[model samples]
Target: MPNVPAERRRVTLQRPGPLLIEGPVEVTSENGTTVSSDRFRVALCTCRRSSIYPWCDTSHRRRAGADDPRRAQPPPT
Candidate 1:
């Protein structure tokens, strides 16, 4: 049998800096567990310290969307 990926997986980019995930999602971690959900749209925290865990708690507002520039920046000299 051939392997098949979920056809419903999709991602949306928001202007205010929120990534919207749609359809079925399979979130996996090193803990050997995977979280699956059918939520239409869900937000994931990029701040890495979200009080809401996987969801964004608007923590980015504290730094005005500049909390982790180094996260996307190249290695320091």
Candidate 2:
């Protein structure tokens, strides 16, 4: 079979949100752990709050102000 080159991919930066990238992507942590995904598009997390590290889970959409009622509060002492 003839060898074929992969198409060039582009990345889109969404304001106040995750970075959208064309995938088959592999993300590696500082400790050398790697995670990969073959999705047509991937949302890379910018905010550190994601429970699923390196992937956006909409955790960045939460209100940032203390006045916002939707913000998670600490347990009462």
User: How much lDDT does each candidate structure score?
Assistant: 0.64, 0.79
Give the residue spans of candidate 1 off by over 4 A: 1-5, 14-16, 65-77
Residue 31 lDDT, candidate 2, scale 0-100: 90
Each prediction's TM-score versus the true structure: 0.55, 0.69
- The superposed Cα distance between candidate 1 and the true structure at residue 76, in angstroms, equals 32
In model 2, which residue pairs have backbone atoms overlapping below 3 Å?
A: none
lDDT of 1 at 8: 58
**Candidate 1 root-mean-square deviation in Å:** 8.2
Following a full C-alpha superposition, what root-mean-square deviation does model 2 have from the true structure?
Answer: 7.4
Candidate topping TM-score: 2
Candidate 2 local Cα displacement, residue 9, angstroms: 1.7
lDDT score, candidate 2:
0.79
TM-score of 1: 0.55
